[model samples]
Target: MLKPFLSSSFVSGTRLIQRPLYYTKRTMSTHSHLDDDCIFCKIIRGEIPSFKLVETDKCYSFVDIEPLSEGHSLIIPKYHAEFMHQLPDDYLTDILPIAKQIAKAAKFEQYNVLQNNGRLANQAVPHVHFHVIDKPNTSTGLGLTWKPLKTDMDSIKTRYEEIKRNL
Candidate 1:
């Protein structure tokens, strides 16, 4: 039998509730692809504490400790993958939808959905994770500087063709 515990949740508002089916540590650790040394894997297995927001069969989300802005959070696949391309499609399917739901539940009017790949790209963790950063004001959240490159249409078209052909 599953155990029940009193917890607060935000569906529309805070309400006392029982733990979700996936809340059990054993169930959360059942993903066969987890990386033993990974911090996220430790969190999922209850080895580390986290303010977890959501957990599905394929994904888990929680508040960011080093938030860029208020309401900053992270969503990650249950499976361990160093890069997005290495993750299975089934795991990818849950990420965006969960992110959207989290944004809505948080009542964030403006936010940025961001992800990084390699160390050069500023990916601090070697795991596939998405960030939902709330932009309550101009100074908060992700700031960007656009740097457009000057290129010939021929070069662009050739590259596009190559990608399309592979797809």
Candidate 2:
């Protein structure tokens, strides 16, 4: 369910823009994540178009417009959540199953699951989404180049202890 809205705003890279959003003429939604300005909300409402692959009461699956691989896809909640921590517990649990099914349907042997949070975390869109990339489907899957640094056992223990303390 979503509230009536004329349009939605979204961040494309560092720039923000407003675009049309379509609402299905439902009663006011109580979902906290249903932001009127979020692009994902517009997508859920069928405003901005998407090559949707699956639709559920609480979730939606679609192909990535900017695919890292041929079978790359995205799974999201119907509601908008800026980050995983902002989403409801059930949404977090529901999205993964949808992603798994998408992978199975594509007959992917290997893939990568990715989620980004804030800007520094490379979250281009201000909505919670999971990227499912079929590694075997294309050579560009993820294309992530990581710099691995060597660390000693004591450093590992210190890092672990730091995270534990913060938690």
Top TM-score hit: 1
Clashing pairs in 1: none
Off by over 4 Å in 2: 1-32
- Give the 10-residue window scoring lowest on summed lDDT in candidate 2: 19-28
Candidate 1 wrong stretches, greater than 4 Å: 1-26
lDDT of 1 by residue, 127-154 (tens): 8999999998989888988899999999
Residue 149 CA displacement from its true place in model 1, Å: 1.1
- Model number with the top lDDT: 1
lDDT of each: 0.81, 0.75
- lDDT by residue (1-167, candidate 2, tens digit) is 43212334557899986643323333325454577788888887778899877665566778998887887999887677788888877666456666776787788789998999999999998998998998874466876778888889999999999999999
Candidate 2 has what TM-score? 0.72
